[model samples]
Target: MNLYRELAKEQPYFVLSDMQASMGMDAEAKRYMSENIRSEWFLGMILFNTRLLHRAIAKGVVFAAALTRSPDDPPRTKIQFVATREKALELLEQWRAQADGGRG
Candidate 1:
């Protein structure tokens, strides 16, 4: 969470997380992180090579592709999950394009 707070200082950044070698987190940690996440901190995040349970959890959070917010609404971070680095990069490019007013 500290790392995320630090990263939040750079508001418009994106994250590409490789979770293949991760040991996984407990329910308490997951709840803590999710509840504490500041949606306005980052543009989007991609989690690649995640386990099945992680993928399910991610899907339950919010899908980047389905995000739709009015200018008057509060910010919501976009999150996506993929199986490969290539797919992750591809999705990140799409998010960048959207962020840049479709110019990316």
Candidate 2:
């Protein structure tokens, strides 16, 4: 199953699908992050029920088509998409460093 991980001090975060728009817990999911999680420079990619991808994007979060039903991206979108846990962390680190200023 997928999971949500908001790295401490990391500018980006990965929030698994079930955690965002599963049938019975959608509100709970958003609340968990909107309220519980706090950060100024956080880039968050929230996973939603495969079906919720379209709608979720309408809500604010950007969805790279490559991340829809699978954990891996094909090729073209891969450059714009960050799917794996490690890559997400790396992206976040880049964001964090940039936000801190001086060097990224």
Candidate 3:
């Protein structure tokens, strides 16, 4: 299993993954999120294709940003899961939205 410490720079939520890459697959996304994320504020995984492009979302640090390449598969340099980086930031934003009372 892969270990991703934090999800964002100011958020508390984090993501984890067992697969090296998501490639837009839902199952891989789930696996990655299930393996790494271990926080209460953490949300579900954001499965994507490439890590090199999405690395910025994590803020540069592999452990800090996102887990590039899976621990299960070293040859591959892809990421599978994604979530919030900060808990306070997420809660505050969510709270604000709720207060605003937007609808789907």
Candidate 4:
């Protein structure tokens, strides 16, 4: 858990595995989400090769920007689930288009 807390320091979102074929989401991860995330706006994108992590999407941080698709995965709405890196990047561009939206 300490490692994850340190990871949260580096970015708005952090991928839990390094070059693994897949990632596993567990209760400990959820605990970290509750204690670590704080987003006044949208949370950053998390690209994973697995569907088990979707449960984290409800953490109350903010937008996903997009979650790259995993076939056999269930349909997800209200949050974007992309099919590729290019698609995720495109969604990011679209999401930031409104920027702050407070200026005239």
Q: Write the per-residue lDDT of candidate 2 for residues 5-83, one digit (tens) a residue.
A: 3343443443333332345657666555444332222244433333544355324333333234244633221112334
Minimum summed lDDT over a 10-residue window in model 3 is located at 73-82
Alpha-carbon runs more than 4 Å astray in model 2: 1-55, 58-81
Q: Which of candidates 3 and 4 reaches a greater TM-score?
A: 4
| Candidate number with greatest lDDT | 1
Per-residue CA lDDT of candidate 3, range 1-104, in tens? 23244334344332343224544567676556545543333333333333654545332333432355446733312233334335434544554465458651
Arrange candidates, best lDDT first.
1, 4, 3, 2
Q: Give the TM-score of candidate 4.
A: 0.40
Higher-scoring candidate on TM-score, 2 or 4: 4
Model 4: per-residue lDDT, tens digit, 16-96?
A: 222123345466865676455443222344343425355355433343312333446432323455555566666666555
Model 3 misplaced regions, further than 4 Å: 1-4, 8-23, 41-94, 97-104
Candidate 1 vs 3: which has more TM-score: 1
User: Model 1 over residues 1-104: C-alpha lDDT tens digits?
Assistant: 88888978867588888877554667688788766655566777799999887777666555432354456766556778889999999999888888889975
Instruction: State TM-scores per candidate.
Output: 0.65, 0.33, 0.22, 0.40
* lDDT accuracy of residue 94 in candidate 1: 88
Q: Over all chains combined, what TM-score does candidate 2 have?
A: 0.33
RMSD of each: 4.4, 11.7, 14.4, 10.6
